[model samples]
Target: MRPPNTPPARAVSTPAADDTPAADDTEFRTLLDRLSDKATADYYNPFTTFDWPASIPTDELWMSPELLSCHGTELMDELSPAQLRTLSRWESVNFYSLNVHGIRELLIEVTRRVHTPGFELPSEFFHHFIGEENDHMWFFATFCLKYAGKIYPDRSVKLPEAPRDPDIENFLVFARILIFEQIVDHYNVQMAADRRLHPTVRHINRLHHQDESRHIAFGCRLVRLLWERLLDRGPDEAARHELRGHLGGYLGRYLTTSIESLYNPAVYRDAGLPDGFALRKRLLVHPARQAAHAKVLHKTTGFLQRIGVFDARH
Candidate 1:
């Protein structure tokens, strides 16, 4: 087990290179083009991908307690044996609910890119992105709707606008989107390996996980190139600081989004936890969950710091 308080493994910083990345940029674009070509032919329509006629088993647990965010006082050593099982079930549903909501928003953003001027190339990847996220949203909703009879709506987690300049909005959006995708990708990978999950849940996760590997690859390459491209253009120090601040807040939100508002903590109140809000606080700060939080956030954080977006001394 990872020791408590030991910082999670994260990438260290490197000085920003001050040269043009024309060759590297071309190489990255070529790779994305190849992925677009492959996706154009190989993409599966989400509508036909799954057999939705099967009934979801309501009693089946979708998440393990170990996977739940650590902030709940009723978790781990604090829970009664019976409550532990319920906690596991709640966490699973909570996880799926967040996916349903987040994917919906991301799909909205991606769909806007399709067939638009200046985004024609990215529109190819968006086709694949929409296809994958639509399937993801469907199965997650299918489980919730079939078993629970409703899908949860988005929680209130609106982030403050990051520094705005026409010059930096493109870079900022690239960073923001990448940060969100990386966190989701972490959960997808982890859940795919969890044997306690029901078969249908596992099948959905495995398929989503398989597709996200490519999305992450594309996002990572694009974000890196975008950052490099921006840095080469030489923003002022104030702009750099604003970008870092935005990234930090975005990172924190990405890490804590599910823990903060995804579940009706009131469910815990019904489950014999003192009150729902207290349970929310407990889980939000739990060491194990926090570690998992850091694990996901690190993908984007580490990349940013290494690429000179979040310098330590600043």
Candidate 2:
């Protein structure tokens, strides 16, 4: 079943020659082709890429302390080192679980659109996109299963239904992809660099970030191309307005849900906290946490606003 508020799966019409991407859009097609080539060359077997120790070392942290669920708050200070370590490992599992589920949804979106009536050259890159996403899902799920005993269930963001116009629908899907990659990349880089973490954990973060860097670059360029088309093509003011509202609120809700995943009852319970949900509420509302959330989302939100796709006041 489709999760609440998550974007509905799109159904694309059979491709036709007339619907091939415009010849004049050479730059966009060329860029995607170039990126696709890079992905192929950079491919690695996630299963064998990391030296997964027979057992993950419990002495080391799994994530950067600063990126912890309760970082910068009184709740964070309340934890002993042992409790903090447990939280770090569980939270790392939660993070990877989100990536696994997010990639699952992304695969659905791109699989349907690639080679459809409206896609042609870009379909070429969609092949790379889909391939890379599959690898990502595998590594993330594998890590969770091997180290955490179970993968965290998807409770991140709930997307709304798809938009009526294909242009708007495409825009939103790519935008969501961009949002997800950027946020996850933040954790990847931070954890990858933290020497206190296990080698396998660091390798996982580093490897994923390397791939995600390309993904994020492609996402930015693709969104820009789509935005230019929106400017020149259809979707009247009313439609644009509605999409803008959706983008703003969708991102707002996405950020909220992503952060809330940190406060999962399991993380707290594992960390030895008696009442997980109560502490979660308090941490979420903390002044420091609020600021941190805004900071985490700042760059991507700014980019969307600059492109005129997101209107916060709308």
- Measured by lDDT, the strongest candidate is 2
Model 2 C-alpha lDDT per residue in residues 231-303, reported as the tens digit of each score: 6564698876765676567656765666676567777787678898788888889899888877777878788
Model 1: how far is 204 from its true place, Å? 0.9
Write one digit per residue (lDDT tens) for candidate 1, span 1-314: 00011111111112237734447655765877877776666567666776765664545556655555544333567765566666656656666777777777666655654665545446667777788778877888887777666655555466555444543454555555666666666767767787876776677777777777778788777667666656655578787666667655554454455335534575565456677886677667667656666665676667777877765532
TM-scores for every predicted model: 0.79, 0.88
Candidate 2 collision pairs: 5-159, 5-160, 6-159
Shift in Å, residue 259, candidate 2? 3.0
Model 1, residue pairs in steric clash: 70-283, 71-282, 71-283, 71-284, 72-282, 72-283
Backbone clash total for model 1 is 6
- lDDT of residue 168 for candidate 2: 63
Model 2 off-target regions past 4 Å? 1-24, 231-243, 312-314
RMSD of 1: 7.7
Candidate 2 minimal-lDDT segment of 10 residues: 1-10
Q: Which ten residues in a row have the lowest lDDT in candidate 1?
A: 1-10
Counting clashing residue pairs in each candidate, in order, gives 6, 3
